[model samples]
Target: MAMAVLERFAVLSSPDLDEFRHSVSQFLTPHRLTPLAGNTAGVHTDLSKTSVGPVSLVYCRNSGVELGVHLTENVDYYDINLALHGRNRVTFGRDEVVVDASRAAVISPRMRVDMRLSDDYRQLHVRIERQALTDHLEAMLGRSAPAVIRFEPDMDLTGPAARGWLRTVRILLQDLDQPAGLAEHLLAAAPWANLLMTGLLLAQPNNYSPQLERIDAGLRQPTPVRRAMDVIECDPSADLSVDRLARAVRMTPRSLQRHFRSALGVSPHEYVQQVRLARVHEELRLAEPGTVTVTEVALRWGFTHVPRFAGLYRKRYGTPPSQTLRDAL
Candidate 1:
């Protein structure tokens, strides 16, 4: 079983940073930090208006080789780190990269990331909730974030405009002592941050290869297909005719059929029937005999035509639905 934990914190002092780090360590799997080679490390953090948004900022220090540090926690949020003063090295999923005062990094919570700070490094850290980042970025970029993104080892972060934006946001954060209730802070920051990040991403050469670009294009079109499948899966008892599905996806019936054939090499009506039969088979295999009738199971998944449904079910499953239901008892 997967364990999930969500923690919300507002820190305004040095002590708060200590407490927050402790909480984060405990929440993740047991992870320890040690000094890096030939360097000593120290950290200082101050928070201004923490309640303004889901933004949590911290300051970090390092002066040597830091080792054995692993972010083992599976977080469901967004962590964006801006290196203000020190160089940071990270190993995420076997891909190693180093970030410094010139560049920023964003890591999703579910992945593990290990950090090694340079002895002279100091930085500002920000963690935003995952959904907030995605929704905001998608709206601003007119696309979705890829499943994974790791900056290449030699990627540059020297763009003056990008650096200026980051500085301005940090200054704004430093000036606020509490959340202003005048407007939604997240809504206000979403565009600014997305635009800034978008520019940064585009500036990185080799960020999107031909294969990756093709995959990205495919993901955009798959939404309609996924939605049609969801409707069928959600209520298998309903009529899932191609005409209905086509209307649901805002396409003509012929177009829908063509799409399914091109994408999955199957007709839409056949797909629905296959799904319904599979659902009925599962229920028969797991359900108690007296609790449900084979005919009832068939009808529940849109098999109103009893004889035809049974004939097809037996041919596909190599047994009558009634026999499977009886065996479950």
Candidate 2:
């Protein structure tokens, strides 16, 4: 038997159409499901949900049955659906898309949706709330035009940004599935949730994509201070004490400390903490959720005391180290 996605949070389980309808109705509104086959005997179905931040990660699959879904009402969310294996069809009037492991179907809000799902169509549904997405876009563009948002019908999962997006999704789902996962604390989980939305907005094209592209192009790398900051950032997990940084930058320890404080308002030691904290954040986001821990990340960045590192991380990011191990899709 294949491992079920989101199996830790099963929300529905049924053998056929009637029970599936009844069980799923309470979960969604203004939608209907019908079996295309004359009979659905011996077919097994399962559904699960994990809500994080402003989005819901939903999983559903069937043993082997042709099913149709209709959404006629104006909905309030977007469902970016990806099948782990097999294929599914989605149509918006004349436009249509086929989604599988390398492609995704973005079901936008308020659109008339017609769907055909068959066989072992196991899928992970990234359900993001419509207005929250709109709000996030406004913040990203630094404007509040009071306009709604829409996206292209399909997403290519093969591109670099899209692949990163998928990895982030895996991180979010796999990490939260654990007993001591990032979902426990709002401080950690909420930002990660926002980050997931942000990644989707940036990765996939939308109405404001041109402007987003412009903004992305405008971003410049941070300038290093006397090349010492550059060396420290190159490998933040190194022994970046004042003496070491001074040697690298060709200055006495006292001179290096004074220069760092004068240029950045922090001593060499304090500056290293900022860089190491950022490295930890970067690593946590990219780390395989089930395999890496916050403690491991801190120690890797030369943080000897886990509690002190946690405090600094929380203060700097308004989130904890563990909560950051997820994002995207």
Indicate which candidate wins on lDDT: 2
State TM-scores per candidate: 0.44, 0.65
lDDT of each: 0.57, 0.76
In terms of TM-score, how similar is model 2 to the real structure?
A: 0.65
The alpha-carbon deviation from the true structure for residue 39 of candidate 2, after best TM-score superposition, in angstroms, is 2.3
How many clashes in each candidate? 12, 0
- Candidate 2 ranges beyond 4 A from true positions: 1-3, 221-329
- Against the hidden true structure, what lDDT does model 2 obtain? 0.76
Tens-place lDDT digits, model 1, residues 92-131: 7767667775666666556677777665455555555555
lDDT of 2 by residue, 225-247 (tens): 45676777678788887877778
Report the poorest 10 consecutive residues by lDDT, candidate 2: 217-226
lDDT for 296 in candidate 1 is 84
In model 1, what lDDT does residue 280 have?
Answer: 82
